[model samples]
Target: MEKVLFKIAKQWIAGDTVDDALIAAKSAYSLRRHAIINKLGEYHTSKKQIKVVLEEYQKIVNSFRKWKIRGAISIKPTQIGLSISQKECNRNFEKIIQKARNAHVFVWLDMESSEHTDETIEIYHTFFSKYERLGIALQANLKRTDNDLNDLIGMGAKIRLVKGAYREKANIAFKTKKDVDNNFIKLMKILFKKGNEFAIASHDTKIIQKAQSLSKKYPRKFEFQFLKGIREEFKSDLVKKKFVVSEYIPYGVNWLPYSIRRIKERKRNILLLGSSLIQSHRV
Candidate 1:
């Protein structure tokens, strides 16, 4: 049933075209909700496909400026031709960062698998050294992330901290919910103290509880970010408390992979809520 729901969720996906992503972004912006639009395809099969992806991104960036919208667009390194070459990836990112500056927008680099963490950080650093409008993601579940935060802190980097999605080796990532939550809290303190621009990207009640308490400590520096279809109630509660709330707006017809990941991730979210994870993904 979960798989079936995911199969049907493809309709909720924005579309395969650049125009579809723009329409969805406009709607999200109109709701007084900021979006993080992303092209749905990943792991490009050829450089040509990657070029197509970059051109599409250029279109999205341009549309955001032309439409006078305020939001962000997130990109997976692999989707932007990362698998082919890191040098090329860095070049592509540099170009986009420049374009993003003209639009008065930010570009968030989405975290991928465990193997790509170091390279991703390096890519971010290389550009962040020159670009200020760009932000990067960090997953709390990784063992080395605490130290990674230390390095990023020295640079005063902006971050969106998530509980991580990619399945990783036991040595590199904790499998238990308790361990992951504990690590997330520990890292949360570091980000809060660094006084860096940050977002709490998780749906765990316990994590939200921690952020609620922590928000009193920072006043307005921290925000709670959740995916569009998950954890609907907390957004209002946080805004009422005067803490910022950001929703991740993922749009793309190739939602099959993202939907599948959401289903597997539901198992973890359900564990957090002490409820069943199943949901009908009616389109």
Candidate 2:
């Protein structure tokens, strides 16, 4: 039954087209949640495909102003041919940033696998050198997270910190959940101390508790971010507390891979979707 539901989840993805995402973003923004619109395909194989993806982004960036929408975008480095060449990735990123900034929006560069970490940061910082609107996401589980945070602290980068979803070797990432959470808090403390503007991006209850408790001490400095359609009850409770909150609303045609991954690791996500279905179709 779990397997069955994950299968259906793939279909829930809003597809590749801009209109599809624009509609979803409108609803998300209206709900008092900021959305990080992600157009799906990762690891493009050619420049032609990269250009097509760029055009897709332009479509969304243009619509945000046209429709008077409030949302930003999350980008995967590989989607614009990072693997093919870092230069190619930088070129593509610059194009996205130029277009997004012109529309008064922002772009958050998502950290992919470990292999692309260095080049990704290099490219991201290169952009940050020019555009303050281009932001970056950092993973707390990574061994080098602290160093990265320290080095990039003064840039005023909009960072969304996650415990990291990708499976990695024990040496490169924290093997225990406790370690990850501890590291997350430690990093959060650093960010707070440095007065860096950031989002507490996670759905973990204990971590959220720690954040909320700490946030109470400095209520005006932080915001919590979560994925759209996940952790609704918790988010509601957080909102009631008056802490700024956001939903990472992903749309676009290539969203199927995200669904496939959720199905593949259904243990973490299946319950969130299954609960709603079970409640609706109670026996």
Candidate 3:
């Protein structure tokens, strides 16, 4: 059952190694799409495990450089050791950032759940000036994201706006799809007006249309980002219209947890999986 489920989940994750990821990324690039590659795993307590992940990222950086792939790497704080200590996590992050910088590869800090928000922002700010290409993801569903956007705008930070996937309390996050979508547009406008560069990350046609409308008014450096497999046809149409598009490509051995979290975040994914299973059984 687990193996069958993993097969369904592979639509989201590229594969389980840098080589596999690059192959997937190359395919995307061939279609005139950019990619953001991420290795799956996070919240580690062991220093040895953290070091191992760091090493994997370094390999990713080297591969990007060698292949001349026009993409960046996304990383989770805990994957580098944020659960152990912010200081330790920062140290590990800096090491990867420095290597990426030398290789001219961008490194994006991914925002996890609400608990790590403030610390993630602080760490991003701490290194913003030192690393010019560093970027961070922001969750639009969070109630405080408006203020967070305003604050980070002053720093000229590169931000990726996501609809947010983690489950949070009513007080902390928008509870309804309508509210979340509204907030996503609101935050997108803020970034468009004030940010230096940003990525509008979503698969919703309505939100993308809203962004398209807003872009005409508040012109700035920005692009649209989507998950690798979701809405490929729409993404291609957007690319045809000359809008910059990037795909978030995740790859690693620890795909199960990531896949489970994805399903938990979006109930529709379960229906998709069931449909796929039924079709496969028919086959």
Candidate 4:
């Protein structure tokens, strides 16, 4: 059953090894799109577990240079050590950044639940000052994201704006697709006005079209990001038009949780993915 499930999940998941991720990245490169590789799992409480995760990230960063791929690594804070202690997480992230810096690789800090937002931003700020190759993901669903985006832009921080997959209370997050999409566009306008070197990470065609329209007015240094298997045709079209595109890749044995989160993220994700799956079959 597990094998059967993995076969279906592999549409989006790379596989259960770093080699699998590298293969996916190489393929993305062939299509003229960069890759952002992430290992699945988060909220780790044990130091031993954290160390293993940290070392694996270090290994991934080291491999990027040897593979000759133009891409970055996205990491969940808790997967490293945020669940254990902020100090430990910072130490581990610094170690990875040092290695990545030497290799000229970019590092992205993925935003988790609202509970870790403040600390993750703090960590991103600390390292970003010393290392310009670092970027952080921001959730557009949060009510506080507009303020957060403005503050980070003032700091000249590189950001990847995501539509936030974690569930949250109605008070802190926009609960409906209409509301979240509104907030996404609201924050996107701010990025075009004053932000640069950011990522417009979404699969919504309307949001993507809005970005294209805004780029014409502002001409900022930004790029579009989509998951590994989603929107392949659109991604190819964007690349052909000379727009920057990136494919987010994840690989690990812990695929079940991530797959569930995708379904729970938004109703639109389900429809979009369903359409993609059907289109894939037709091809």
Judged by TM-score, which candidate is best? 4
Candidate number that wins on TM-score, 2 or 4 = 4
TM-score of candidate 4 relative to the true fold: 0.96
Could you tally the backbone clashes for each prediction? 0, 4, 0, 0
- lDDT comparing candidate 1 with the true structure: 0.75
TM-score of each model, in listed order: 0.88, 0.89, 0.93, 0.96
Error of 3 at 260 (Å): 2.1
Residue 93 error, candidate 1, Å = 1.3
Residue pair clashes in candidate 4: none
Cα distance off (Å), candidate 3, residue 107: 1.2
Give the candidate order by descending TM-score. 4, 3, 2, 1
Tens digits of per-residue lDDT, candidate 2, 63-88, equal: 88777777788889999889799888
Task: Enumerate residue pairs that collide in model 2.
Answer: 15-252, 15-253, 16-252, 16-253
Worst 10 residues of 1 by lDDT: 274-283
- Give one digit per residue, the lDDT tens place, for model 1 in 1-283: 7567654454345666777667766765675556677787777758888888788777788887787667788899998778888987887777788878887777899999888999999899888877777788998889999999888878988888898877789998888878988999998888877747888898888888987877668664666777754554576667666666666766665677776776575476534322212332232
Candidate 3 at 129: error in angstroms?
1.2
